[model samples]
Target: MRLPIVAGWPACTVMNCEADQAGYGEDKCVTHLSEGELGGWLSRLGPEAEIHLARTQLAKGTLDQIKGAVTGQDDVPQFGYLSLRRAEIEGGVDLCYSRFSKEVDLYGLKVSKYLDFEGVQVSGGLDANFIEAPQGVDFYRAKIGGSLNLEGSKVGEQVRVARCDIDGSFLLRGCQVSGNVECYEVKVSGPAYLSNMQVVGDISFRNSSFSDGVQFFYTETSGYFNVSDSEFSGFVEFEGLRIAHDLIWERASFRDDVTFDKADLSGLVQGSCLFYKGVNFIRTIFRSAVIIQACARRVDFWGARFEVGGTLLLRYAMVRMTGAILAGPTSLVAFNRNFVDIFGDPMDEFVIPHEDPNVKLLDMGSVNAGNLTLVDIDLTPCRFAGAFNLDQLRLEGEWNFGTPPSGRVGITPFTWAKRKIIEEERQWRALRSHPLVLRSGWGDPPDNPRDVPGVAALMTTYRQLRKGREDAKDEPGANDFYYGEMEMRRHNQSWGKGERWLLQFYWLLSGYGIRASRAFGWLIISMILTILLMMGFGLPQDSPKQEAAGTVPPGGGKVTFEIDKEDPRNPIGDRFTSKRFERALNVTLNSVVFHSSDQDLTTTGTYIEMASRFSEPVLLGLGILAIRGRLKRGS
Candidate 1:
C-alpha cells in the first residue's frame, strides 16, 4: 500500500509536448476548461503541474509504471510520489520512468520496463522488468525499503544499487544481464534470490548483508565477483552455476551451507568459502580446479561429506587442520567415470582454474572443522560429470576409497583408483603415525607397480589432484573421538604388505641394516647392563653365568675363550702373589656368596653338556666347509 502521486491535474497552455507528458489539471483544462480558469497559476509550468488519467483500469493487467521521451533537457517531466500497488502488469509499463526527476514508487505490482526507473525512486521499489537496460538501471543514492523484485526481468544495463536499504527479496530469478551490477552497501533483510539469473558483466556484493539467503542457483555468469565481507545468515547458493570469470569471495561469511553443487567455475576463485560447521554435498564437480591464483591458501574442504566429480587441483593450497584430508583418486572416481576422457592426453578446456591475484599455491591449507560435523562422502562416477571440486569441502567423515569392482570393465582407472584409495586408507594409520622406515636418507626407490609407482606414490598423486576444497558453513565443533572417526578411514589403517616390502628392500640395500642394527644395538645394550649390574654388586663381571641374562646365544655356551693375553680373561690368576689379588679373590668369593645371578659355570653340568652338543653340530658343519675348500683346491 503505497501513496500514489496526485494526478489528472489540468495542464498549462504553452506546453512543449502533448497529452501524456502534461494533461488536464483537475481544476481546469479539459472539456470545458482553460489554463486561465485558475488565475493563480505559476508563471513557469513544470511536469507535475499538469497530469492525465487513464479512462479505465487495464483489462488484462495493471500497468506498474511508464516511460516517455522528454522534449528537451530543460523540459524534463516531474512525477512526484507515484505509487502502483498490486497492479496487474502484462504487456508493459509505458511511462514509468520517462524523465529523470520523477519521484517514482512501486508497491505490489508487476511491470515490463522497455521503459525505465532512471532517476525515479528517491528510495522505493523501482520495478523495471523486460527492459533491456543497455545503459543499466541506476538507483544512485536512492533509499529504498522493502524488496526489489525483478523476477524474470531482463537487464541490459548494469544494475547499480549503491547505498540502498531494502527489506525484502531482490528477486532476479531467470533474469539476464549483459552488464555489471554494483550493489555496494545495499542492505537486504530477506533472501536476495538471483537464482537462474545470467550476468555477462562483473558482479559484486561488497559490504552487503543478506539477512536470510543469497541465492544464485542455476545461474550463468562470465563476470568476476567481489563479495568480500558479505554476510549470509542463511544458506547462500551458487549451486549449478556456470561461471566463465573469476569469483572473489574473500572474507565473506556463511552462517549456513554454501553450495556449489555442479557448478562449473571456469576461472579463479579467491578467498575462503568457509564451509559452515555442518554443510553436506552429495554430487559436486570440479574440473581443473584452481584456487587463489597467487595467494595459494588451500581452501578448506575437510568438511566435505559429499560425493563430487571433476579434476581436483590444489597445487598451491594450504590444507587446513591436522585432521584435514587430501582426497585421493578414490575421491574423484565420479569425475574419472563421468567427465574425464581417457586413452590419450587430457583435455585443456575442461579444466577450471582459480587464479585470484592474491592467491598462491601456499594458500591451499588444512581445513579447520574442529567444531563441526564431519563429512566423508562416498564417491561415484555419475557425480563428477557435474561441476564439483573436492577442493571445496572439509570432510569430517572417514575418507574412503570406495566400492570394489564388479567386473573387468569396472577395472578402469576409476576402479584402480578405488583400489589405491582403499589400500592407502588401510595403511594410513601406520604411515601417519609410527612410520616403518623413519630415517631420512638417499636410498634406492623400490620397484614400482606395473601401472604406476607403489601405492603411496599413487595415493599422493591422487591427493595432488584435489586442489580446490572449500567450506561454506562453519558453526560448531566436533568431539575428538567422533571427529577422528569422521576422518577418512585411510588415516586409521596399518601398513600393508606393499609398505612392508618397500621398507624391507630399503633396509637390505642401504646396508645400514637398520633393523638388524637396532636389534644388535639393543642386544649389546642389554649385555652392558648385565655387566654393569654384576660389577655394581661386586660380583664376577665377565661371567655369562650372571643369571644367564640373554637366551643361550644361538650357539649354546661353548663360547671359546678368545681373549687376547694382554686383555686377560680374568683377574683370578691360578697363583696370585699380591695381597690385592687375594683381597679381590676374597671379595669375589663373598660377592658370589651373596649374588644369585653369578651362577657357578663349573657346577652347571647341564650347560656344559648342552655346549658339548652344540659344538658337535658346529664341528660337523665346519668339517664339511673345510672338506669343500680342500675339494675346490684339488679341482
Candidate 2:
C-alpha cells in the first residue's frame, strides 16, 4: 500500500520507510536524514551561494516520536529558517557549532533527552519559550542577535549557558530548572527576567554582565546561588527571593539600586562588591553570616533578622542610611571602619579617609537584640562631627571601641615626642585648607557647645552597656562602662553651670566615686604638702601668760623649766622649739588624721585643718568602697 518513489528526487534511504517521501537531493529523506546529510544540505545553502539555493524552502521537518532521527550536525551549518514547533523528539537535539541566519523557533517543543546548542550563533532570536526537556539544556558559547526567550520552560536537568552573548533580553521567567543553572561569563545586552523562577539546584552566574536590569523576584533556589564577579548596569532586584543555601555576590558591581526586601537568605557573602546606588535589605532574614564590603550611597537593613552561629561583618563599608536594625539575636555584629553620614547632604563626599569633613552619624535607635559582640568600631572620629545614637539598643558582650591597649613597653620619651610631632603635622596638613576645619572654632565659644545631644546619646549607650554587664555579673566590666557613663555626664553641659563644676570636682577628688586608689594617693600628697607648709611656717605658740612658769626648784643645771603648757589635752603643747621636723610631723598628723597632736597651729594651720577635715572623710569613704569592690579598681 506504500506510495511509489518520485523519479527526479532520490528515494528515502531510511530503513522501513513506508511513505514515498522525497529525499533532500541526497540519499536520506528529509524526515529521516542523518546528521552528516543535514550538514551537507546546510553547506549548499551558504551566504555566498546562489540566492535561490540559500532560500531553498525545505519541507517541515516533522520527525515526531522518531526513534533514531539525528538532530546534530558536525560542522557549523548555515540555516535559513528552522521551525521545530510542536515537535516531539525522542533523541536529544545537538546543534553544536551551527549558525542560523534567520529565526529558529522551538516553541512548544518537547525533547526527551538533553538539548545541546553549544557554540551556535543565531542571527535572529531564539524562541524556546514553553519548551519541555526532561533532560538538560546547554547553550554554552552561543551568540544570539535577539532575545533568548525561555519563559515558562521546564528543564529536568541542568541548564548551562556559560560564555553566551545575548544581544536582547534573556527571559526565563516562571521557568523551573530541577538541576543547576550556570551562566558564567555570559553577557546580556538587555534585561534578564528571572522573576518567579524556581531552581532546585545551584544557580551560578559568575563573571556575567547585564547591561539592563535583572530581577530574581519571588524566585526560589534550594541550592547555593552565586553571582560573583558580575556587573549589573541597571537595578538588580531580589525582592521576595528565598535561597536555602549560600548566597554569594563577591566582587560584583551594581551601578544602580539593588534590593533584597523581604528575602530569606542563607549564608550571604557580598564582600568586595561595589554598589553605586542604594541597597535595600528591609525585612530580610539571614540564617548565616552576612559579610558585606562596599561604599554605597545608602544601605537600609530595617527590620532584618540575623540568626545565630554567624557574624554580621560590614568591614570598611560607608553607608549613608541610618543604622541598620538587627532584630533577632546575633552572635557578633561588627562594623569595622564603617563610615556613616546620617545628617550631612546626600551629595557630600562620604568615602573613608575623607568622611571626617561631614557629620558621620550612626543612629542605632531601633535595635532590640542582646548578647551581641560589637568589635573593632571607633565612634570617636565620627563623634567629633556628629552623634552615635544608641538609644534603646541593648548589647551584652565584649565592647571593643577599636582603641589599642595603652601600656606598651620599650617606648622612650624621645620616640613618643617624635611620633606626636609626626601625627600633628599629618593632621595639620590634612585639615589646614579645609573650610569646615577653618570654621570649627570661629563662632563657637571657648566652652563646648551646651545644647548638643551627642553627649546624652553617648551616656545612654554607656548606661545600657553598663546595665547589661551588671546583669551578666561582670562587675569589673560593668564598672568600666559605668565610668564611661559618668564621664559623659561630667561633660554634659545641660547640667546647671554650677552642677557641671561640681561634677568635675567630684572626678578630680575621687574619679566619680570609682577611683579609690586615686583618692588614697591624693590623701598621701595632701599630707605631704601640709607637712611642708607647717615646717616652713611654725605652728602658733600660746601667749606667754598662758604657758606654765619656769620652775627652777631642784637640780638646777641650766634651769630646765617647762616652757610649754602641761594641760591634759596638750601634753606637747604649742611651744617655740628648734625641732622643726617633729613640729611639722605633729601638726600634719593633727590635720590629716584628725588626732589631738601636741601642737596648736596658726591661722594658716587652722585653714589647712578645716580643708583636710572635709577631704579626709571623702577619701576614706572612697577607699572603703574600693576595698568592698563597689567601685572600679584603678579606674
lDDT of model 2, residue 49: 20
lDDT of each: 0.41, 0.60
Give the Å shift of residue 10 in candidate 1: 22
Candidate 2 residue 553 C-alpha distance from true site, Å: 17
Compose the digit string of candidate 2's lDDT tens values, residues 1-635.
01111134323455764322323355544455466766565444443121111112133232221211222344345565565554566667777777777767776677777778999898878888788887889999999988898888899888898899999889888889999889899999989998888999988889999999999999999998898779899989999999988887766778899999899988665445557666877877777766554556556666666664245444333332223445344433334344232233122123334432221223333444343344443232222112132322334333333221233323432111111111111222233343553323223221334323455665666676667656655566566567767766776765669878888887777666667777787778877776766655545543223564566758655665556643222213534356756777766666555665645666566676677666765677776675555533432
lDDT value for candidate 1?
A: 0.41
lDDT minimum window of 10 residues, candidate 1: 474-483
- Among these predicted structures, which one has the highest TM-score? 2
Q: Candidate 2, after superposition: displacement of residue 105 in Å?
A: 5.0
lDDT per residue for candidate 1 within 59-150, as digits (tens), equals 32222212122223554444444444233334444442344233343333443432344333333344433334344466644454555666
